[model samples]
Target chain A: MMQKSTIRVLLAGAAIATVLAGCGARDKAPAAQPQVAPSVAHSSGNAGSSAEPQAPQSKPQAPQPKTASVHTYFGDENGTGLVVKQTTITYASDSDKYGAALKALQHPGDSKAVSLFDGFTFKSVKLESGKLYLDLKLDDQARTGSEAEELTLQALQKTLFQFPEVAEIYVTVDGAKVDSLMGHMDLPYPIKRSQ
Target chain B: MKRLWVGAGLLLGMLALPQVAMAAGGATTQLFLNGKPLAAEVPPRIISGNTLVPVRIIAENLGAKVGWDDRTKQVTVTSGATKLVLTIDKPEVAVGDKTEQLEVAPTIVEGNTMLPVRFVAEKLGLKVTWDELTRSVFLYKKSSGTAAADSGANGGTSGAGGSAAAGAGAAGSTGANAGAGTAGGTAAGGASAGVAHAAEPDPDSKPGIVQAIDFTGDRLTIKTNGVTTKPNLFHLSGPERLVLDVPYAVLDEALKAKLNGTVGEIAVQHPLAQKIRFSNYSSDPPTARIIIDLKGRAELVPVEAKQLQPGQFAYDLKLAKYLVVIDAGHGGKDSGAISVTGKMEKTFNLAMATKVSELLRKEPLIEVQMTRSDDTFVELDDRVAFANTRNADLFLSIHGNKYTASSTGTETYYYRDESLDFAKTIHKHLVPATGFADRGVRQEPFRVVKGTTMPGILVEVGYLSNKNDEKKMFDEAFQNQVAASLVAGIKDYLNIQ
Candidate 1:
């Protein structure tokens, strides 16, 4: 599991990897310490420490995402509608994050979390013609309205765009291009990652 | 003074002809281009105030190959520069980079595909004219818009200023929050308020028509028909051309005569202020785009002044300056997040944004502008527009986080991959100063970052939902400290002293 509790420490080390390189690089900085700051996360953690960042205990291995974490921007009923929450979703293989992310979207674990794909059924997600075709089945085609449908599409589009391998998103209801979700909001316009 | 007055009179004479030529009374319209008659098989007719013609008739002659998918009910028209996609009975048409709503959908006529003539022509770069008296519709591509259209090919509303379109919006704060304009934004839901989706159809919708265009003293003001419109204005370098897009506006053939759409080449000489070009970027909620190519001694000034009218805007060109626009997250009816202390997160955001701007201004040659200098509500789209039109080098949006009083930390977000380094560079310095848990720099599709063409970041400084975090954040002195820290971080990221 790629826990923020762990990766943060290593990320902090990478941020200060210059510190461990023995001050030989920059001639005029503070004398370099060859240690990694595993406790760097805590420096900001309610510690209220005003001191400069210290060096971390040395580690030989390179910093990389050995354990993957899924960052989900779930709609928060309390605050700004959406608050990002992380899940320790590491795959057995490196290529498994896509499946895991979809699973995470199905259930991201929040009491106030609103379902973006509620009326729509998840039929399948396929890569066709350089675009990701997300085929869905509608539960109630007649009554979808402005508020819920737009939010759902926003959630779905944002979530799918996270995976760069999936170039664009084309949503279909019961294997057909939809005009709108409930009545007003339109759908399946080949959603691309916003530049 | 003499040149400015001369250009203004010429602009009046140039633009006045189109409005006079398009006086409405047409049942059936004939096609004409550059004084030449255009013959069509099906003939063009008006439906519900919009003109519709055979897709093949207009599509084929405009140097386009038309294709149809009968099973899918889709019509795809491919041209050299633009691809037009429309579905039968569907009110939406996909133009390049935007999905525009058609006032009337396409239908099959006899054996041919029929679509909105104004929409198809405007989207395909063909200018349209409807003479009510003659009942004639003219369609043709100008041989002169090369310099203007060529400028359109190079992307971005900033870096080099370009076109902009403004659609009048309803007074729905949270209602239009549902107006999802977040192009590739990762921020999930509309937590803030007063974000009205301008393009949504309503009876209150105003027509976007260009009234008058005046080029005086290096500034160009493209006035609209009735009410004023917020125009997207830009100017390109290397020949210095001004481009303006009036959203929800339409054009008649008279305006086409003024343009020189010889794609990709700038005209250096013309009898009327270098060369002039115009294109209808969109028709559903129609947008009228005008580009003026400037010649020797022509330079655009950075200041943009909105006239006394509701939508009259005048701007000169300003290029290659390192200007930073700091946006305070939410305001007024857009309460943003309600803190645990019952304080609005918008309060904190504005405070932080103000401080950052104040501190950054202290730096030499660094320009700083706040999206909202006070507590006035600025919509999501407008916030990006302010940064873009201002030609900011970097943009920073400030907001406080909200959750179940437990999720606490400082997290910085970016939309594009290029902004990651900018986000990280700021987070590296900003997070440590907050004395909050570092959530790390992450990439999320956010409007402030995604909607902008420059390096932009949205900083969630701390969680107001958390009591401890709120305590530190609520401190006015603490906000000033965070603001100063943010400024230092920006300086670090920008590599300025």
Candidate 2:
């Protein structure tokens, strides 16, 4: 068990390193969102550091923590299937990272993609015993068809399930459990990872 | 003003495409008027976030006069002393001398002048309550002071005797008649249907208000007041009868009136059942009983019981033929996984599922159903529920996989233990036809496989991400070979010649 866990940790580190490298090589990102994929530039404290000196200087001379790029799912151009995109997120802790991932759902990587999460305002995100509870305030009149409602939940599920710690997810609107997102398709409370 | 004029044309376009039309309307929203399902050609639909219904149906049922003016493109509804005028594609409705703004304009769908029912019903002194669990809309007349008090008296009596009825135990029928402590609670049954339109917070009041027992096609749907309760099901062998006993429930007045005689027989037409019988069962603990008398040694198999809404439940019973649900995963807006060649996994899945469905249809003993026949976005939950509600014997979800380019093979997945054998049999015939590496039958918690109760399998024909696999997947001849192999596997699993 010890060896298996050690190997798993090594594989995870390698995966993160690969993602960090990819973030560094992606120079064709939109100019307005230049802060996108700043993992390598920020962590190494070199290369792009000359452009933004204060960013590196703000922290002590100690090795700066790297920004991690996570895979975020969003609605495609037609608002049909979910398209995976890499989003760079900075976090002070694990809980902060979970919140950032949820917040990322609201902003799609591309203009053509849609975000079903716009109607929800994230109230609180709590993780206990591998179960993640997300409390959100949903707009009273935000109703959609069956397909849209299902797709929205699927996107939310796919995005959050990427975190290894989140074994299950439960969503509450206005701090109350709702039967469905828009009176279409029943939502399983504490949606299992398998779901 | 110009955009409003396009409503008719837009509606026509939507109707032309059956899938689009289904999506535009909240698929499961049922409308009830005076305690019965409103027999409307078009179901209630949400347009621009507002629930709209045919004004004619509710108006006529409420004993109101409805008039349409062709020249002005306006509808005039006069219910008692209140008069309301609504113009086509207009956002404002004239209620008496006052004008009220509508968030969504009145649109003509299928020649029916659809209006936001809540606004129109309220204006006509009608009460509109929506049940989100069942997506049901209840339209009824407003209650008077005397009516409320009368219903309250019934509730008080029922509440008092609730404990005595509970003590009556499983054989509630015998103990209930003797303990008539409910004091002719039949009045509550008759009046409460009209009085209690929504689930009130009062615990003493009836929670399980059995709204209507609907028998349509091959299904029996029990509409309730959004209270969840499990019904005890048992079979009697003398004449082959199935009994369903629902606890903590009382039949609504409209439904109780349909009971016909002391036995509460409900006349129904079905291949399996000779007739259906219903009764209040008990008043204090509140229970309802439905008995289905089978015909000619017809085996009444309790296939599935689904909660259609929080308060609504449907039971499907099957006899003779085996039902197989063919699901084509992801369509229309949901392209699923995009292939290396830019082809969609949705198209491949639909094509494969359709081919297998056609083969299954030819079999005499096998009845085939497809979750979707064409390009349409069906929710994952909807697909599972659709199969479950129909009580299908087998479920097959077709899809193409997507991963790294190196991952190229055909694989089959099953979540439930019962489905493992089915998946293995299907994989045996399927993997060889793909002419790819055999990944073997594996256990995976895919939503489609996990959600379905029946022995179900999701077959990943080949990886869409791989260039070689993607090329082969697009080949029509290869698809035909896979489809034929799949059908053979199904026949093998079912032990059919």
Top-TM-score candidate index: 2
Which lDDT value does model 2 have at B150?
Answer: 47
lDDT of 2 by residue, B1-497 (tens): 00001111211221222211222243445555433334343456777667888765656555578898855878888987889899888998899999989998888653356878888877776656665544556665534432335433533334334344343343344323322122111110011122222212223445477787777777877777766355555444445666555655777888778754434666788877887877776443345767678774333333344536566667676665678999987776567666777777789889999999988888877889999999998867668767765657899988887644566788787889999999999999998899999877867556678778789988889878789998998898999999989988989998878
Model 2 misses residue A114 by how many Å?
A: 27
**Candidate maximizing lDDT:** 2
lDDT of 1 by residue, A88-156 (tens): 333334444454455455454546664344334566777655588777766422122122334556767
Clash totals for all candidate models:
37, 4
Q: Over 4 Å off in model 2, which ranges?
A: A1-195, B1-149, B152-319
Is model 2 an incorrect, acceptable, medium or high docking prediction?
incorrect
Candidate 1 per-residue lDDT, tens place, B219-250, comes to: 55565655434554443334445555464465
- Which runs in model 1 stand beyond 4 Å of their true positions? A1-195, B1-320
Error of 1 at B131 (Å): 25
Give the DockQ of candidate 1: 0.03
- Which stretch of 10 consecutive residues in model 2 chain A shows the poorest summed lDDT? A38-47
Candidate number 1, chain A TM-score: 0.55
